[model samples]
Target: MPWTLPSRPSRRSLLAGAAGVAGAALLTGCSDDRPAGGESGIPLERRMREAAVRDSARLLERYDATAADHPALAARLAPLRAAVAAHSAALALPPAGSRSPSASPTGGTGAAAPSAGGEPVPPKPAEALTALADAERSLSEARTIDLAGAPGELARMLASVAACGAVHAYLLTSTPGATS
Candidate 1:
């Protein structure tokens, strides 16, 4: 297979993205620019949503391979994956791609292999849930910060994401151990 270069960023696209982010910052005061070591100010809600989507994709890929054993679990997980995909699309985040389990990761000698056909893979789920929770926690902290200082839409959107994250966490934890 031939490697294709990523498309160059267009000036208009760059400006538009910057404008959205800057507007978000100006509205929410969550700008990336801050005094050294200060808060990142990036909205946690958006971050949480993005993270959840990514986690969902990875989990779906794993579930897809093992769905034969747990049809109901796979079915339940399918909607969750769809929800994640929808949320990711709404936020304009990149989608996950399929890759073989044997592919080597850049920094390690041992490749990160998919588990044996029916082996329970707890760590991925655990790590994903933990990250999702952390993102929600961060959003909560951001919400507590004075929104009187920034833009209304940014603050509102951030708060919305916090709520979404909480809901996502509950959904993830409540799912069965062997989903289809």
Candidate 2:
């Protein structure tokens, strides 16, 4: 008897594979010598990557502050905080000639957010959530504006992260179990 052919892969699997391939390419293929902007001899892409890391760190700080101040909400914010941590890891620029991504220069689990240091968290849980949502929205908008000038792979990554940030903003404020 003739053997049956293998079933076709689902659309979800295909897209996931494509994304993995694309991410690998970007990680291993970012080679450029041109300097778009450098006040202290840093390339624009490097600056952008650093900025992304810094912003994510700040967001993580906000998440941590909210969780610490409002232990009751910690469980709810944990997943979102983990996502931001992963974003922080992914946004880091690898050392020269390295292909894989690394964590930020701080090397602190969640302790080195420069700009977020000393910022007071709102006393009310709702207000704190609103602050987090505002931060996410602001960062998302900034990333969207930055997309026009970013090169190929960086632009794709930035767009994706920006979209994630927008989604985070919506999630932070939108009521749970609300009817349509």
Candidate 3:
């Protein structure tokens, strides 16, 4: 008997299989079994959220410092800085028991000003932007790596914020308004 070739997979079947694989991947990433509560009694997810907020605040401070040190770039940097500020606020946690865990971040109207501290801004405008871009890129990579450990809602927010940071890094280096 001759062996026959198998029929091609239907589009719907293919899509369904793909979705299952994607979901499994997400589940696998989220299945990290580290202890739920740490020495401080805060759960891993909460600590992750807090750390994200602090990182955003520091990034915001860096943006502000860069803008102040290089006033000429201020106009170009304002929108990106505002975006960072928004990320910080969105990552802030509401008072304990004040809101549902699945609900979005709340409690703070804005991130408290943070300082990256000590390092002076670069003297040249291009150099300052490069430094800012570097910071954004580094933080974005860290957040991306962190998604594996984050729970559902927090993971989604981290992904969004991380994408934004990457975009900010790109924009700072190649401003659309520039004639180049």
RMSD of each: 18.9, 10.0, 6.2
Clash counts for all predictions: 7, 0, 0
Ranking by TM-score: 3, 2, 1
Better of 1 and 3 by lDDT: 3
lDDT leader: 3
How does each model score on lDDT?
0.46, 0.76, 0.78
| Candidate that beats the other on TM-score, 1 or 2, i.e. the better one | 2
By TM-score, is 2 or 3 better? Answer: 3
Q: Candidate 3 lDDT, tens digit per residue, 96-170?
A: 454665555633454455563635788999999999999999999999878766776677788899999999999
The best-first sequence of candidates by lDDT reads 3, 2, 1
On TM-score, the leading prediction is: 3
Residue clash pairs of candidate 1: 27-150, 27-151, 28-151, 73-179, 73-180, 74-179, 74-180
Candidate 2 residue spans exceeding 4 A from truth: 1-33, 93-111, 114-118
The candidate 2 region of ten consecutive residues with least summed lDDT is 99-108
Off by over 4 Å in 1: 1-71, 93-120, 123-155, 175-180
